[model samples]
Target chain A: MIERTATIASTVGLHARPASIFAEAAGAIDAEVTIARAGDPVDEAVDADSMLALMSLGVEHGEVVVLRTGDDTAGEALDALVTILETNHDA
Target chain B: MHSFVGVGVFRGRVIGPVRHMPPALAEPPVGERLEGSTAPETAAAALKSAGATVKELLQERASRAEGAGKEVLEATALMATDPMLIKAAIKLVNTGTSAERAIWEAGEAVADTLKGLGGYMAERSHDVLDVRSRIVAVLRGVPAPEIPDFAEPFILVAEDLAPADTATLDPSKVIALVTAGGGPQSHTAIIARNLGLPAVVAAAGVTGIADGTQVFVDGATGVVSTDPGAAEHAAVAEWQEKASLLSVFDGSGRLADGTLIPLLANVGGAKDAQEAAAANAQGVGLLRTEFCFLGNSTEPGHADQVAAYKGVFDAFPGKKVVVRTLDAGADKPLPFLTDATEPNPALGVRGYRTDLTTPGVLARQLAAIADAAASSSAEVWVMAPMVSTAAEAADFAALCTAAGLRVPGVMVEVPSAALTARHILDHVEFASLGTNDLTQYAMAADRQLGPLAALNDPWQPAVLALVQATVEGAVSQVKHSASLETTSPKPVGVCGEAAADPALAVVLAGLGVSTLSMTQRALPAVAAVLRTVTLPQARALADRAVAAASAAEARELVRAGLPALAELGL
Candidate 1:
């Protein structure tokens, strides 16, 4: 499994527009991906492709989250997801 | 013809076939378990398909909408297609819950979660619940609750329309508005007046009138008469001719004897100022400065205030622009300036009184107003609201002088100011009668309460008495300063909603009020009515108004006194 850490850049946090943009991008990729607050328990991770799941995590502005993928082909997909999380959709 | 009576708002007359607002959705039945309902798998499939269909529908609408509206529809569409919702619903269904109940429970759960977040996130709960209703309606084959859609113009009848319900209301397609519920200050009444449509509110039985039923709505008399015959048709034609006569203002206000009453506009900000200037208002009488203070956690700096005030002053060059200082607290509480938990804000620190608790705020605002006035050619007059005592008026006038703002004024909103008007006017150059607040203070009625709207009217004898007192006091101030024959009577202007009423404007003129400022749209009607009567005739009407026992009686007496008003269809 490959893991990456990306900080939320959206001023309003990982919810609303930013979360929707990130989740849509994640869902389009061909891999199993999950995300959670960086310091939280690994088992608490939720599917990254679900907009509601990403929002329910309540990850706020400038907070860091860990993205993990079990699929070998998901490296590039994880990078794309990280780019979305770090880009401020509000801007 | 059958007739129903309610309070009239605005003096418009229209006749059209009625169209009732669509019925709201009923709460769906829910239970712990599905007894003979569809199986879990079948229910899950149905839920999925319904969600997809709703999402598709919303997306299609979003494509046609623009700006914030399109964003809202798109966000709501996302809520419909949320996979987490289906997952939660299936989890509920696996525990023997019916599909409908499961969906509702899941939607509620998410909405509750959003609400708990508070502020911006909390507002999204409404969208989630809306999506839940659409999905449930799709499953049940029932049409979603929405605003009625029709091609031809029709009079809209409703049971108190909420903002959400009127999102799809096409204003152009609506001839007038009739509601079974709501007062003169209610949303329905206010929107109707703003749209310049005939509106009658608080008419209890008007909603029961069937769709496509022809009805005559007389907004002046608050009458909704059904099955109009020849007389009503003739009245409508007469009204149309009179309405045309109540035409565009010629930028001047005069009595039949040719006494000029400077007709000014009450503007909120720059946009309103520009519109008022275009409408040919003599000038702005009440430039509410709340736009600078409202929404700010801390006090706005001098530069921010200057920039904002400059936008308005720039609109009316060489015209009178009366700017009021930050009138915060009471109905308009500012976070940085007011106590949120005050027992009775209306009676407590409000308007000028806010400065007692937070000093330097009003001073800073005056400085800003002075700065904006310096660069603009507009004749800027500054005023303080809620000034009661001569001492309070003196302090405000001194502050204005200190800030280099000439022509200082005080608003006669409190009863003490009206009762002791001569003393208050001694301290300021001008006094403006704020009839809305004066009525509220005199009648001891909350202006916002629907049941108290009758008592809160300016036509109330007590309120009219206060107006006369203020105007008389201003004239008395002039007589007291007789040593300087060049000095004019301290002008007492009626800068309130009452001034918008054409009949009341004439009565105000009769009472010796020097200026009349109101909503720009009402300027022409008021100007039209004022030109029909001489100053002496207006004084006779004013005397009759002051002697009436109640608001309704006084309004009737005044309307009757102005026979030309009926000709103007007011």
Candidate 2:
């Protein structure tokens, strides 16, 4: 599995437009992607492809979150989602 | 004809066939477990297909919307197709719940989570509920919910209408609206009046009126008379003809004797300013500043306030723009500014009272208004809300002037200020009567209480007496401030729902009010009715209304006094 940590860059966090954008990106990749707030228990991890799950995480700007994927092409999927979560979509 | 009465939102008469709104869809049935293992798979497919249909529907709506409406619809669309919601629903179905029930439960679960987050995230619960309803309809093989459109004019009958339901309504096709539910202050009522549609809100048996039944709606009297005969039809036609004739008398309101009454618009922000301008509002009477304070955890900085105020001021260059400072208090408790747990926040610390305790907020806001005024050509006037004493009025005026604002005024919404209007007016240059709150305070009725609606009528004798006192005080005080040769009464305006009423506008004028500010849609009718009477007749009506024993009696007396207005605006 490939794992990476990224700071939420959207001023409004992973909700509204940013949540939709991140979820869409993750949904497009062929992988079982999961996300959780940094230091959260493994059971707290939610499917990255689900807009509701991403938004329910209540990730705010500058907050750190972890993304993990079991697929071989995890690098491409993580890069796309990390780029989405790291950019201020609202701005 | 059978008649039903409720509160009228505007003055006008409309004759049209009834068109009832479709009822809200039922909730998914509970406890219907999946029949077999394959039931989960079938439910998953249903969920996906339903989500696609909803997404498509929202996409179509978003494409047609503009500005904020477009943003809201697009955001809702994204929620409709959220993969997490679908996966959650599928999981619930796998747990032996019916597909429809699973979708409903999963949507509620996520919505509850968002609601618990509070603030902006909590607001997203509405979007989640809206998306869930759409998906549930698809699963049930029912058509998606929408406000119906017609090829011809019809009276819209509904239990109640949400903002989205009414936003896209075709004004030309909807002649008038009669709702079985909703009060005078409901958003549906406000929008109907804003759109110039005669509306009767809280009319019992509104939904019971047969479809396509011809009805005569008198928005002035809040009377919906069904199955009208020839005589009623003729009266309606005559009123309509007169209304069309008076449509030519637009612009500044005036008395039959040519007394000028500046009709200004009460606007919320830039968008409302634009609408007011389009409706030929002479100036903005009440530019509410609440929009700036809403949705902010901390008080907005002077620059943010300046930018927002400038947007409104720029819309009405060279026109009078009276802006009220943050009216926040008990009801709209700002976490950063107010005590959320304060008992009786309305009566305790609100309006100007809050500002006195929390000086920084008021000071910054005044500075912002001053900046906005310097940058725009509109004649900016600043006012304080909930001023109960002459000293408070003087302090607010001094603070406003210190910040470089020229026209300083105070809102006469409290009984003490209204009772001693001359004393209060002596401290400020202008006074705007907020009749809604004045009625509330005078009658000791909570404006939010539906059962106490009778005491909250602007036509209540006590309420009218207070208004009369304020107007007379303004006239005397303005004359007191000016030279002996300049005998014009100090400019007193009515900026409330009462000012929008044609009959009440005349009474206000009779009581010496100089300007009238209301929603733009009510301006034309008010202007039309004002022209039908001389200054003396208006005073007579005011005297009659104020002398009546009760609100109902006062209204009846005024209606009897101005019988011509029944068909004059038509």
Candidate 3:
């Protein structure tokens, strides 16, 4: 498992458009991905490709969410996802 | 030939075969009766079928129902399965009647019983009408009996039409409409005039003519004839051609006598602003800001508010956009507004009154409008809704001004505001009358309820009395402030349904209203109406309107009063 911490950078946080975008990107990769807010017990786990699951988490801008991925290409997926979140997907 | 006349809601002269709507689609047949005496089993199946039909109908109309309509539908669905209707159906089945016949008889009996119970049944009937119409339309395989198509521009005739049914018209193609079963203030009539289609509602015997019969209809005269003589047809055609030519706007909102009346557009959102700009409207007269709060549980934050405001402001760069601050309350409830509960919400804390209870919400909204104005070149003017007294107007003005926003106006939607307009103008830059609400309040009529609909007359002397009071207050304010040159004259504007109405527009302009703001779709027709009369002529029309007995009479009087201008335009 590869784990990393990323800060939300989308202007609208994780509510509408940004949440959908992040979920789409996560789901494209073949890995089991889980996200949790820092120090929060509740974690959202999915196949890394479901937009609905990501939106249901209600992640917002400036919040630090921890991500964990487990798969053959877990390292590459983790690095790419962290970079996207950090840049807010250039939104 | 049997002819039924209703109101023509949309413009279009169509000639099509009469297609009655179908009954509701039945669900898969419940198992057949096992024997000759299976009353209970048959009753159960019929009840199940009715339940399924009601559920499907409710789901179909869920998105289309407005706030009150939604609640009414849910209540109606519950009533559909009420014990009374079921019991009646069972009794009929036990007597050896067929399932469909039993259900129909039970429905009629229940309808009659509930009619005596009053409002609930009336509302349920409306739902039933809606459901029945849909089922009928489905059965007939017609596109909901929309405006028909004729080779030549002609008159459309119908028995009755839903607002949704009326909305499906191509205004450019339709000339006029005559209906058999709608009152003057019916949604069909309102929508007809809004679309610039001359329509006569409640015209009895409109549908008596056979299909494909040539008909001559004078929408202005409420006259219709089947297979009119050649001369009559020629005259009608000539009049329509002349009217079409005269409805053109010359970019400058001026009459032949050169009286400049700024024609503005009433917009609901950013898209409407763009449409207004495209249509060459002078500017926005009323930019309703309530859409931002729709479908939400909490008041929009400052940023969200700013973004929405900015969208409108940006759409009309360098043009005036008057933003009415969140004019929400009982009539338009927001899920986030918890304290808005009231039996008579229309008369309750709404518009500016609701703001007083939640000052923070108002402040945030005002601040966002200010911030949006600062960011865009669009000139933004802020207004408040439902200011009944001068003090409320003054306080609202102070808040907007303090926030660096140009507080151009307050809407006089209440009769009290019209009565106290002079005092209210003391605090604000200008005022606009929301005639729809003012007329409702002045006549003590619930505008939403259909039976009290007669009292919703815009031309009732009582309503004109309020308008007269508002105009008098405005004139007095202008005169008193004339000496102070720094203080610009408080120009009152009419920014309501009344303003969009071409006939009413003349009356309003004559009543000392400097600007008329109406729906963007109405700007052209209103502009056409403005070009037909001078300020003096408009005033004369207003006088006639004030003296008229009914709205129809008032409309006729205004049209008659503007004969010369009307001749020039039409």
Top candidate, metric DockQ: 2
lDDT of model 2 at position B218: 82
DockQ value of candidate 3 = 0.02
TM-score of each: 0.78, 0.84, 0.65
Residue B16 CA displacement from its true place in model 3, Å: 5.5
Better of 1 and 3 by lDDT: 1
Per-model RMSD to reference: 5.2, 4.2, 10.8
Q: For residues B1-570, what per-residue lDDT tens digits would candidate 3 score against the true structure?
A: 223344333332323233222222343233323246655565557555654566465655555677744644554444444444555666766666655455555555545543433322222344443433333343234443345655555555576556645644666655566666656566657667666676766766556655556666555445556656666656666765765665455446665588887888888788878877777788888888988885444567888888888988887788778889887765566634524336677878788887766668888888889999999998888889888888888889888988898765798889889998878887888888888888878888765544555677676767877888888997778677646664445778888777766777788878778888877766766677677788888888888888888866886777776664345433
**Each model's number of backbone clashes?**
0, 4, 20
- Where is model 1 chain A poorest over a 10-residue stretch in terms of lDDT? A49-58
DockQ of 2: 0.59
lDDT per residue, candidate 2, B208-291, as tens digits?
888899999987678999988787678678777766765543677899999999999999899999988888899999998988
lDDT of 1 by residue, B1-570 (tens): 889998888777778999888666666576756656568888888889999999999999899999667877877787787877878988988888877788888999988877666534555677888888888888878777666678889999987776677666677999888988777766676567656788898898987898899999999889999999888999889888877767588999999999989999998889988988988999999999998776444577789889999999988999999998889887677756777657798999999998899889999899999999998999999999999899999999999999999989999999999999888988888888888788889989887676777777788899899999888887788788756864677889989888888999999999999899988888889998999999999999999999999888988898888898766667
The TM-score each candidate achieves on chain A is 0.96, 0.94, 0.79
- Candidate 3: where is the Cα deviation over 4 Å? A1-91, B1-182, B194-198, B205-218, B224-240, B243-247, B297-304, B329-331, B338-341, B356-359, B448-455, B478-483, B547-557, B564-570
Model 3 chain B worst lDDT run, 10 consecutive residues: B14-23
- Candidate achieving the largest lDDT: 1
